[model samples]
Target: MKRRTFRAEVAHVNRPLGEALAAELGVPLEEAARLVDVGAVYVAGRRSRDARTRLSAGQVVTVVLEEGGQSPLAAAPGPAPTLRILHEDEDVIAVDKPAGMTAQPTEGRVGDSLADRVGEHLKRTAGLVHRLDRETSGVTVFGKTPEATTALAEEFREGRARKRYLAAVGPVALPPQGTIDLPLSKDPSRPGRWRATRAANGIPAFTEYRVLHAGKDFCLVELLPQTGRTHQLRAHLTALGAPILGDKRYAGAAQAGGIPAPRCLLHAQALELGHPRTGAPVRFEAPVPEDLARFFAAAGIQAPSGPIRPLEPPA
Candidate 1:
């Protein structure tokens, strides 16, 4: 396969370079991003790979297409799913990762995960700083460079990064709001499942929840896990007796109502951390997905139109 290059003029000013390029070439958005990451996208004869760069009107943009460089999102059998990069820079990019997508590759699954898509978009294997459950959707971080990757890992490891989620739970109502401070450990029988324990060897996990609104059958809440433990919130909520809606693994979403959960109603709504390169505090929020928002409305639970707030104010 030969390398293909296309040149176009930016007719619209202040538009994302990737969107412009994608439209110009009719490639998927992720592919446009991959082109930028590989220095295939340029402006003013200078190599520019940042997909989020706003192109000025009259800027001559060039896109060099690498043959066989199909993005995972594009290579999939059907229409590609739409995913957006919330923010990006030289060192890192924040993507609005979709629900039901794995964070990275697994056994027998190579190019079907968010890591694969974003990795191709960035034209390199991105360093995943953190992970969201396959059923959880929200702002996910990917390190574009090795230095950025290491710094992001350190931020989460040192407990400098903060993450918050929005969830819907129901049927057996909780006590308005409360914190679940318990220990968590893997369940031997369930293999991948986790359980709350008070055993000496169990790892401590703290999850806080505040009721946003109460519906006849369900309640919307904002959840914060102080410690990053696998299935922490799901286990904690089960212990609270109000399982999240659509969370069949723990709390049965159908147990709340007759309707089956389309997917786990969990969103990584908020993230706050220091910039990998500058150490400046930065915050990113993912909008409430349309499906989740509809669920809230159907249950008569009010979803916040604005940003979600933590139970306790930021410290």
Candidate 2:
């Protein structure tokens, strides 16, 4: 059997969910309903079995299509190759995304996207609502329905979602706790890298950081950003004089003296957000990955104790 995937923002508001899905996928209404039955349709990030469910504007829906199939509700093979589900509910799923995994499928790649794996787990299409850098592994949230995706994405944009990141930084001058207010923009001349200067076109970025553990040469830092700009934390930390250890792109040295860096020393340690379905606050954490754990040991530093929540909004 061959399968294809499609995703779109919920464009039709207050319409019969079945009709909306059928129109979007160019399928018959009955096929859409069958897709719903098999959990092949997702609104916001959650699976739905009702063809009558009303959809909201700006919500995202993901649909999986079996190119040649006898029944829309027929089951497929087992789950994806690898995924670590941290928390799940009717509307949302939080997975422990390991380092070096792309959040979504890139073109030309086959069957390896994290989102594809998530879809297999849901027995339907699950969409990534938030993203973490490939080198920065941790909890990533997905929406099973278009509504959930819209709500969760808005929370992040409006500063309601809180994220905590841990980074091992090279020697530099840093206060115990302080905020870095630096405007950032893509360096078109440099391409793919960002600059910390107020380049007139630069957007403002804020990162509040604290020294959780420090030594003469390296320190473990906790970062909370106000903006989700690309490479915000790495650029800000580099501006503060200490680049993240093993971050060769931003840090001049990937290794120093006798110590070696296996990979980028950044980790998305924790995430807290309101439940899309219930509005109740929830938190998720991922202990340091082995590579980072090794870095901590080499530095003779300990991970921060207890839950470290974001203290301030990105200003």
Q: What are the RMSDs of all candidates, in order? A: 12.9, 10.4
- lDDT (Cα, tens digit) per residue for candidate 1, span 131-210: 99988999899888889999999989998888888887775566666778989988887777788878636889998887
lDDT of 2: 0.74
Per-candidate clashes come to 1, 14
- What is the clash count of model 2? 14
* Distance from true location, Cα of 22 in model 1, Å: 37
Candidate 1: misplaced stretches above 4 Å? 1-76, 255-260, 299-315
- Model 2 bad stretches (over 4 Å): 1-81, 108-111, 310-315
Worst 10 residues of 2 by lDDT: 105-114
The lowest-lDDT stretch of 10 consecutive residues in candidate 1 is: 1-10
Compute the lDDT for candidate 1. 0.75
